[model samples]
Target: MSGIYIHIPFCKQACHYCDFHFSTSMGKKEAMVAALRKELLLRKDEFKGEVVETIYLGGGTPSVLELHEIRSIIDAVYADYKVAEAPEITLEANPDDLSTEKIKALSKSPVNRLSIGIQSFFEEDLKLMNRAHNASEAENCIREATAYFDNISIDLIYGVPDMTNERWKHNIDKALSFGVPHISSYALTVEPRTALANFIERGIVKNVDDEAAQAHFHLLVDTLQAAGFEHYELSNFGKPGYFSKNNTAYWQQKKYLGIGPSAHSFDGVRRAWNISNNPKYIKAIGSGELPMETETLSVTDRYNEYVMTGLRTIWGVSMERIASDFGERYRNYALRQAEKHVGENLLYFKGDVLLTTKKGKFLADGIAADLFMVNLS
Candidate 1:
């Protein structure tokens, strides 16, 4: 089964570290929503025989849209695509936008899951990140949302300058108190061209310490694992049966159609992404043109993608599948490249499947790079 991801590209404000495509202005929201519906209708034949098992609304903040507007998008999906009997529909929301009434309304809507962006439960961290929601709003929204949505996931950030390990622990403890089934946490990375990066460059903000981030990651893994949440992916921990179907499909390299500006899509062999400019995307869709670009994956591109995604999740890279899918030479090259990591205890073999050890989980990306089939066709 395939999935559908809708990107809502409007936010109340910008966070200091975010580089995702979005606009703070709501001037074109109505027009953009219409364009999104039109895009779905336009792309119906692309997935003619595929059943959509998951529908995800992600972006600047899907919560920014009105209830009817959100419903209209989903309605468009159902009207055109063949959806599963009970698909997992998720909406990525922010604490500031999730009022009590909004949560209640969403609970009754088609959205079955909520991914709340509560970067931190501390006022100082909230200010540092320039998050739209304050500490009180973060806690209160989760408290109210848990009552209505059982499949709720919350985001937390770590390694902020001046943030003590004790404070990080409290953040996790506070999240657990709300009984959230899933938590997605990431280290605060300063992306280039973002406010956070500029501040660091000007010495206004302290540079993010890699050592502190690693310590925080280990603490998170130990605490969450003790609490019975599986470290299903490198950065995602979920209780059994609560894993995100949409994200899982992504890591497994399943087919998905991404709608809206700056969104991306994959269909096993080809990958495509829409234009990042909202006005341009809307105008193109209105004119019956797809404002996107596509590229067919080479054998090496497919192999590298599999290695990158496979090593990050519980399911490691399968040597047999690699040999069959790519070629025997590619599989042999992977084993040769992985020999050093295997000896260092960073990676190990479970039969023919190469998996990362606990000590290696945090460095999965770098390790995957080492095993990448570079200079191969």
Candidate 2:
């Protein structure tokens, strides 16, 4: 099965810590929507006849679009591709955008899932992040969304400066009380060139403490485990039968077509990404040219990617699958590299699956990199 990811590259405001491609300007919304629909029609054949099982409206706050505009894009997708019956359609919305009326409208549309960006439950944290919504809006939007969408996921961030352990736990409990089926919580990372980074560089804001971040990670694990939520991924937790199928497909390397500025697509061996500029993307697409770059994956690149993404999930790397797909030499190297972690009880080999222990989950990336074999031959 395949998926379609549509990036709505418009936001009402820019958050301080964001690096994702988005524009606060909404002047070109209509034209951009047209271009997106045209893009869907133009790239219809890229999926190679695989039924589209998921369609995700992500980025720049999809909720910013009007109901009609959102539906138009969904309709265009159906017109171009063989979308499966009852495909999982998701739209990523910011907390302030999801009013009761808006949630009701979305429920009537093709969107079956809502991924709300609540970030944090504290007004001070929201202010520090320069988020558009306040603490009340975050809680209210979840209530409104849960009233409409059953397959709802809310995004939260921990490890922000002054976010104590107790407050972080309260955030988790608040989400649980709201009846959200899925939760994707992340530790705050200060990406380079972002306002947060600048603030730290200038001493206006304290840098994020690695120790605080690690403590918050452990708090997430214990809190979610107690709530009966599956730690299916490094940053995701969900009740049984509520895991995100679109995101799961991504982790499992399922093919998807990303339609919008800064969007990336992958078939099995090759990956392509669209140009990040909105005006340039719309202009080129309007002129019937696909503005994107393509790259074919080398053996080492593919192995490293698999190790990186797979190790982040509950599904660990498979030594046997690696042997079959990547040849025996690479497989042997992986096993040998995995030995040190296994000895430390941070990794365990159960049958063909080499899984990371709970203690090692927080450092899965480091361990995965350690297991990586350089293709020097």
Steric clashes per prediction: 0, 0
- Per-residue alpha-carbon lDDT of model 2 for 81-114, expressed as tens digits? 9989989999999988888998999999899999
**Which 10-residue window in model 2 sums to the lowest lDDT?**
368-377
For model 2, name the residue pairs that clash.
Answer: none
The reply for model 1, stretches above 4 Å from the true place, is none
Residue 15, candidate 1: how far off, in angstroms? 0.2
lDDT tens digits, residues 1-377, model 1? 79999999999999999999999999999999999999999999999999999999999889999999999999999999999999999999999999999999999999999999998999999999999889999999999999999999999999999888999999999999999999999999999999999999999999999999999999999999999999999999999999999999999999999999999999999999999999999999999999999999999999999999999999999999999999999999999999999999999999999999999999999999999987999
Q: Model 1 TM-score?
A: 0.99
Error of 2 at 141 (Å): 1.0
Among these predictions, the greatest lDDT belongs to 1
Which candidate ranks first by TM-score, i.e. highest? 1
RMSD of every candidate to native, in Å, equals 0.5, 1.0
TM match of model 2 to true structure: 0.98
* Model 1: how far residue 364 lies from native, Å: 0.4
